[model samples]
Target: MARNSADRLLRQFLLKAIGPIRRLGIPIPAKISKHLQFRGVVDVSVGSGASFKMQSHGHAIENRMYWYGKRGHEPETFLPWLEASKTAEVVLDIGANTGLYSLGAAATNRTSRVLAFEPVPRVAELTRHNARLNPSSNIEVFELAVSDENGTAILHDPGGDQPASASLRGDFLDCKQTEIKVRCVRIDDFLSEVNLSRVDLIKLDVEGIEELALRGMRTTLQTHMPTLFIEVLDARPELMAELNGLLNMGYQVGDLCSDGVIPYDLSDKKGVERNLLFAKDLSRFQ
Candidate 1:
């Protein structure tokens, strides 16, 4: 009874907060708004205050919705690599949010297979939904968080349309306070279990847990030497270590923007931290 009451209270608070944003009719990019509309996910209003109805995917698809609209577009930095790779047979999307990379890769013909991993249940659900909507025969969705160890952990619900880092405190504004036993697996174990010989590309954007995931994939790194496109945020020291670890492994790195690749070295760890890239071999691109 108490749990039900708490849930109701949380719902009310979230609705109250979301209602204002919904009414404001924020301006979203055309492509993003269109995608959302086609999927019947977003009900947006343009400059004229006219109500625009997005195509409904069906009875209000949940867990597969993309929050923040076009902001969810593939980070400009990774586009070139994504386009340049013609022989990429296997793609691994770590922290595959709402199937952006997952759906995009599945849409492309070059990518023969894709494995999307999202630990957050809500986001994972959306990933699965988008994958199904797109219907990629080769895409596989895994609803588990990847780390160095294999076990269950607490997934904090910072409730919104999308899932954020699982927090330790139960203080999300509109999020229901609940504990989900999410699976934690390493890349080596994952590869062994699935018997994957090679991975062409690995794109990771797992909040602040990238290091742990990388640590778990040391074996995969040594074996496949797949090109990695990681979203390296500058806020965490642990993340910095992960990037350094990759560099230590002798991978050449660069930034992927809409224009082209900008090669860089992370030898200096003291500048105003920016999103950078690393590659195992620059000659491959040349």
Candidate 2:
């Protein structure tokens, strides 16, 4: 018990000292900065007229954005996302971690509608808070998970400090025993319920349940044929199934590059690329 208290005190001291260290311009190593956890919200600008609000709590995505803007977080994905957002009338940000993509998309096109889905309660609230921080942007925060079916699912969260890693699958990421039951919905049904007829682009990164969510939106995929920006960590069975599903629907796959997207051969089992673009028409990205 005494050891636990000592450790708690040490952590509190360290968290308090980070601010003064930053004020002194002391260089904090990436490894150390990653583990530094605290609670606070701040508005960040990525230059131009693009900007968003982010809450800091050791989340890699928000921290990177705070330090290096969208480029540092996921330039390959974010750059294309922002470009697509400029003209997209409707965007769905599945697994919207703290409104990074949602707010940015809304900022790029204030008239466009951005629907952000986050299952974790606290994380969803954080997204809402970030949206509120940007009053000019049109972003809707939904505290629900998108899946193949409409029901409730156990969302596994590693911890409060690792909100970005939360997922529907219990085994996904380094999920701890901590879990929460969150409402789930099929994309098709949800959109129909909301009376949204068009979806210009979709940013899907739902940890390991990507396939299930895709399955739920099969109708939308066929009808809307929206441009898709997805994180493909590797060729898992679930991911491959959905990739094949899209490919069979006449969607071409490409790897997001600094210049633009290039055709990607799915046969390469090595899984070198972490992100991919699936679209019926690749010219939109060019």
Candidate 3:
């Protein structure tokens, strides 16, 4: 009981000190700031009158949002993500690291139901805690990895300050510190089991197994035709091949840009890493 009271006092003190430090433009190194300023769950103002609770230490997503806010974290994707969620009723956030997109979606649209899937256990718990911190109850966190199969799989964690880099693929991290066995589920099966008949938007960022996750959700993609937001890094040949299939299914691919989306060409050899939007109609975002 005494420990809890002390913790609450420390939390209150840190919260008070963070704003003044930020306003004064104190240039504290990120390494030091993580330990001192961003310990425990900290409240953050994420712009447009939206505030969120985040764990300041360990997870980079929370750390990034702590220092830079939401818009500053990933403007290209985060902005478009917010825009798309306005019309969505059901949002699937696969590879939901700390539930940023999920929380943003739920906050952007109070009626929208956000299903956040994160394979990492610790990060998944943090996402749930953050969800509870907010007033909205639309976000539901699932601590399971989405893949082509339903069985358990080995997930690689890069550890250290990069908790969001966990992936089901071994090649995803060169500095893999530990392996975790996580439950796997296909989007199609999971949706059916949950009795969800329709989905409006889907954001997939499962690091290396994006193609496999796409395969798992084939039924969802073909039937629901929900808009897709995918993060492609270096345009891996395998994932590109799967994306080509999506194109054949009447989905147009384009990179989410500041002004608008740039059309994506699969034939282009020098493909850079970026978030790509796949939809039957690309003008909706414009």
Candidate 4:
């Protein structure tokens, strides 16, 4: 594989220019951050964009990494919901991750209410902070993990320049172990406690724990039938099964890159690690 001119230039700029600027503690502007296109760069924009009072809490809202004084990448899946305000009433942000989607939804007046659920303590705190920074009463932050059961679990925290997915099962390049006390709640259980009868949209990115959360939301899934945005990781078989389950439940499914819902067939198990969307009705968009 050969690197194109643009790729070579971007790499050189990142290593030579952007690296030293970050070391110098200089804050990059949102517009310049767009070039990096890495996950870490994307995460950093969450904080920077919020500080600058920009809506659409993408990776910029999470990490605040700036490339040439610009904020990082934005998740394309959120564009549709952001563009159409009135379509969504309540949003469920599973694995909220520094309040990107959560805060973004709160920024919109049409998003009546937002419930952000994050299990990681530090990330949860950041989510709360982002929510407060935005100043939306409709947003509620929960420092709990959504799983199949309710209990305490050990979450791995990989600390370093970028400390994400501490709960995941893997070794971090520059990381350490930290014990985070997390509450595991099912969707039905939490919604019942909050008295939420229906949810308009649900976004999940809990690594491999998505299936567990879906299992816990059986009642709500059958009833409200909210539009769901899910990140499917290739590592989990149960999560794949859960996607099959959604298809069996009469929901139309599509990936974020697609224009509309396509039939989900579990037989095609290639490229499971992609962002996908599911909805009971496409008319919701209309």
Full-model lDDT, candidate 4: 0.64
Give me the overall lDDT of model 2. Answer: 0.81
Number of clashing pairs, model 2? 0
Full candidate order by TM-score, most accurate first: 3, 2, 4, 1
Per-model C-alpha lDDT, please? 0.61, 0.81, 0.80, 0.64
Q: Going through the candidates in order, what is the number of backbone clashes in each? A: 17, 0, 0, 23
Show the lowest summed lDDT stretch of 10 residues, model 3.
Answer: 30-39
lDDT of 4 by residue, 1-286 (tens): 3568778577557746676776676766655555544332222222223322322333434334234222233444655444333457888888887766765566554347989887777667777766765664378989887888877776666554234565534342245577666678889888989998888888888766778889999888888888888887673577778877887888877655545434455566774777777877655443
Predicted candidate 1, C-alpha RMSD:
9.3
**Residue runs of model 2 more than 4 Å from their true location after superposition:** 1-41, 46-48, 257-260, 283-286
Lowest lDDT sum, 10 consecutive residues, model 2, at 37-46
Q: What is candidate 2's CA lDDT for residue 15?
A: 63
lDDT (Cα, tens digit) per residue for candidate 1, span 1-286: 9998886576557545654564464544444333232234553222132212222342222212233322234335434444534457888888876656655555443346889998777778877776665543367889888888888776666666665455322442345656777888888899888888888778877665667888999888877788887766554677667777777777887765544566765654542224455567655554
Evaluate candidate 4 by giving its C-alpha RMSD to the native, one decimal: 8.3
Those runs of model 4 whose alpha carbons end farther than 4 Å from true positions after fitting are 1-72, 83-85, 160-162, 168-176, 258-264, 282-286
What is the lDDT for 45 in model 4?
A: 26
